[model samples]
Target: MKFIISVDCEGPACVVGNAGKALSASRDYNFACREATLEANAAARALFDSGAREVWIWDSHGQGLNLCIDQLDKRCKLILGKGFTCRFPGLDNSFSGVVMIGYHAMEGTKNAILAHTYSSESYKNIRVNGQTVGEIALDGAVAGEFDVPVIFVSSDDKGCREALTFMPWLETVVTKQGMGRNCALSKHPHMVQEEIYSGVLKAVNCIHQTKPLKFKSPVQLEIDFKAVSQAVKALVYRRRGWRLVGPRTITKKIESMREWIC
Candidate 1:
C-alpha cells in the first residue's frame, strides 16, 4: 500500500517552549529539527518493512524545511518547501492513508504544549461548523476530500485527544503530556521513536477498519485572528464570501474542503 507521512514540529517531544523555535536558527531549534528527522526516519522504515510499496514524507512544519533530507530513509520520497497548493503536497486519493507526526493542539487549548492553529501570529482560532480545529484537523479534512484516511498521528497528549475526537479509530502515539503551552512531560526521544515505529505498523495493518473524515457540503469557516489588523487584512478577500463576524473574526462559506482551504 501507499501512504503519506506528514511531519510537523511543535509536539512535546520536539520542543520545550515557543513552538516557533523549531524553525529558528538556534541550537535548540537545530536539536528539534534533528529529533523530528529521526522520528520520521523511524516511521518510514517501519512502513517499508511492513510492506508499504510507496511512502511520501511531507515536511509540513514551519518553512517546510525542517527534515534532514540526507538522513531521511532512502526508501521514501520527500516533499519539502512552502507556498504549495495544499498543506499536504502531492496528496490525492491514490494514497492508502496518512500519518501526522510531531503535531500539537488547536489554538486556545489550555495546557497544550505550543498550541496554535495555522499561525500563532495570525490566527487565534479556526472553526469548521462551530468546532475548533488545528492543523491536524485541517489537513485531515483535505485528505478526506480525496478519500484518504488519517491512520496514525504522533503528538502530545492533547493533540492525540483532539485527533481522536474526529477520528476515533485512528492510532495515536503520545510523545508527551503538556503542563502548559510551553512546558510538558516528554518521553525520551528514543522511546518516542520506538512508539512511532510500532504505531505506523499497527495503523497500516488496521487501515481497513478506519474511514476518512469529511465535512458536509457548504462548509462554514470561522477564523478568529490574533489581531484586528490581521482580520482586516483577510477582508481583502471579502468578495469570496467572507463576512466580518467580530473585530478580530471573519466567517466564510465554501462548497468543498478544497474551497475552504483556498
Candidate 2:
C-alpha cells in the first residue's frame, strides 16, 4: 500500500517548545532538530515495514525544511515549500492512507507544547462545523477529499485527545505531555521511534476497517483570528462575503471559504 506522511516538528519526541528554536542554526536548535529528524525517520521506518511500499512525506514544519534530508529513509520521498495543497498546492489523493507525525494541539491549548493554530500569530482557533481543529485535522480533511484515511499520527497528549474528535478510530502515539508551550515531559527519542515503527504496522492491519473522513456538502468553516485588525485587513476580508460572527471570528461556507483560502 502507498501512504503519505505529513510531518511536523513541534510534537516530535523531545520537542517541548516551538520548532523555531528547533530549526535554528544555533546550538540550542541543533539538538531539537536532531530529535525531529529521529522521529520522522522512525515513523518512516515503520511505514515501510508495514506493507507500505511507497511512502511520500511532506516536511510540514516551519519553512517546510526542518527535516534532515540525509537522515530520512532512502525509500521515502519528501515534499517541501509552497504551492502545496491538493486544494492548496497539489498532493492528489492517490494513497491508501496518510500519517501525521509530530503534530501538536491547536492554539490556546494549555500545556500543549508549542501549541498554535495555523500561524499562531493569526489564528486563535479554527473550526469546522463548530469543532476545534489543529493541523492534523485540517490536513486529514485534505486527504479525505480523495477518500484517503489518516491511519496513524504522533503528537503530544493534548494533540492526541483533540485528534479523536475528528477520527475516533485512528491510532495515535503521544510523544510528550506538556506543562506549557515551553515545558513538557518528553519520551526518549529512541522509545518514541520504536512506537512509531510499530504504530504504522498496526494501522496497516486495520486500515480497511476505518472509513475516510466524510464532511457534508456545503462544508462550513469558521476562523477566529488572533487579532481583529488582521481579520479586517486580510486580503480575504470581505473578499468572500464572509459574515462577522464575532469581533475576531469570521464564518463562511465552503464556496466562500474556498475563494478566501484558495
Candidate 3:
C-alpha cells in the first residue's frame, strides 16, 4: 500500500496569515512549522508501520514550503514547491489513500482559526454545486477524481466539524479550538502529534469503508472575491467556461474537480 500526507501550516497551533510571515521565520510561524512537521512525521511513521510501501508528504501551506523538511521522517519522500495545475501535485490513482494534517476551515467561517478557502486575501467564499467548501472538501474532491479517499485529517475543532460535514466517515483529530480568526485554544503539541499517529493508524485500517468525496459531474463552481476589483481583474482575461455572475463573483462550469480553473 502507498499513501500521501498533505500537511498545511495553519492548524497545528498556528495562526499566521500568509507566506511572508513563514518566509520571515517569525516566532509564531516558526513554531507552527515545527508543530506541523512533527504531526506530519507522526502520520508518515504511522503509515509506514501500517504496511505502506511508499509515503509521500506534501507541504501544502502558503508558498508550499512551510514544513521543516529535514525534521520530517526520513522514511517518506517530501513534495515541495507549488503552482501546479493540480492541487495535490503528483497525485494520481496509484495512491492508496490521502491524509490531511494541520488544515483550517473556509473563509468567513465563524471562529475558525485563520480560515480561508484557497486565499485569504483573494477569496471571500468558494462554493461547489452551491455548498460552501473549505480546502478539505476541494482537495478531497480532487482526490476523489482518482478514486482515492481522504482517510484521515487533523485540524482545529471547527475544521474537524467541516470535514465531517463533507465526509461523515472521515477520521479526524482536533489540534485546537478556535476562538477567532487568529486566536485558538490549542492543545499541547505532543498530545496532538500522538493523537495524529494513532488516528492515522485507525483511519488506514478502515480505508476500505471510507468513500472518496466526489461531486456530481458538471459542477457549478461559484467564487466570491473579497473585492470587486479582484473580480474585475479576473474578468479582464476570462477563460473558457468562466463568467462574471456578479460584481464580486465569478461562475464556472466544470466536468470534474480536476477541471477547476478560473
Candidate 4:
C-alpha cells in the first residue's frame, strides 16, 4: 500500500513564539525544522516497516522547505519547495491514506501552541460550514475529495482532540499538552518520535477501517482576518465569490476542493 504524509511545524513539539520569529529563516527556526524532520522520518520508517510499498512526504510547513532533506528517510519521496496549487501537493486517490504530523489547533484556541489557521498575520479564524477549523481539517477535506481517509495525526493534546471532532476514527499521537500559546509540557523529541513511529504503524494497519470525511458540496468558507487591512486585501478576490461579511471578515462559496485550495 502507498501513503501520503503531510508534515507541518508549530505543534507542541515545535513553535517557540509568534509566526515571524518561529517560522523559516529565523534564528530559532532550525530547531523546529529539526524536530519536524525527526518526526516525519520516524513515521516514514514505520510505514515502510509495516509493508507500505511507497511513501510520499510533503513538507507542508513554512516556505514548504522546513524538513531536513538530508536526514529524511531515503525510502520516501519528499515534496519540497512552494508554488503548488494543492494544499497537500501530489495527493490523489492513489494513496491508501493520509497522515498529518506536527499540526496544531485552530485559531483562537486557548492554550494551543502557536495556534492559527492558514496565516497568523492575516487570518484570525477560518470556518467551514460554520465550524472553526485548522490546517488538519482543511487538508483532510481536500483528501476527502479524492476519497482518501486521513488515518493518522500527531499534535498537541488539544489539537488531537480538535481533529477528533471531525475525524473521530483517526489515530492520533499527542506530543504535548499546552500550558499556553508558546508553552507546553512536551515529551522529549526522541520520545515523541518513537510514539510517531508506533502511531503510523497502527494507522496503516487499520487503514481499511477509516473513512474519508467529506463536507457538503458548495462549501462555505468564512475567514476572519486579524485586521481590516487584511480583509481589504482579500476583498480583491471579490469577483470570485468572496464577499465582505464584516469589517474584518470575508466569506466565499467554494464548489470543490480545487477551488478551496486555489
- Per-prediction backbone clash count: 0, 5, 0, 0
Count of clashes in candidate 4: 0
Off by over 4 Å in 4: 12-15, 18-20, 25-27
Summarize candidate 3's per-residue lDDT along 135-251 as a digit string, tens digits.
999999999999999999899999999999999999999999998776778888898889999999999999988999999888999989989999988777666767999999999
TM-score on alpha carbons, each prediction: 0.94, 0.88, 0.94, 0.94
Which structure is stronger by lDDT: 2 or 4? 4
- Full-model lDDT for every candidate: 0.84, 0.75, 0.86, 0.85
Candidate 4, pairs of clashing residues = none
Off by over 4 Å in 2: 18-28, 85-89, 235-238, 255-262
lDDT of 2: 0.75
Best by lDDT: 3
Model 4, span 1-262: residue lDDT tens: 8899898888737455544454655555778888988898999999999999999999888788788899988888989998897777778798889989999888888888878787777788888889888888899999999999999999999899999999999999999888887778888889899999998899888888899989998999988888998898888955677899899999988887656762
Candidate RMSDs in Å, in order, are: 1.8, 2.9, 2.2, 1.8
RMSD of 4: 1.8
What's the distance in Å from true for residue 54, model 3?
Answer: 0.5
- lDDT comparing candidate 4 with the true structure: 0.85
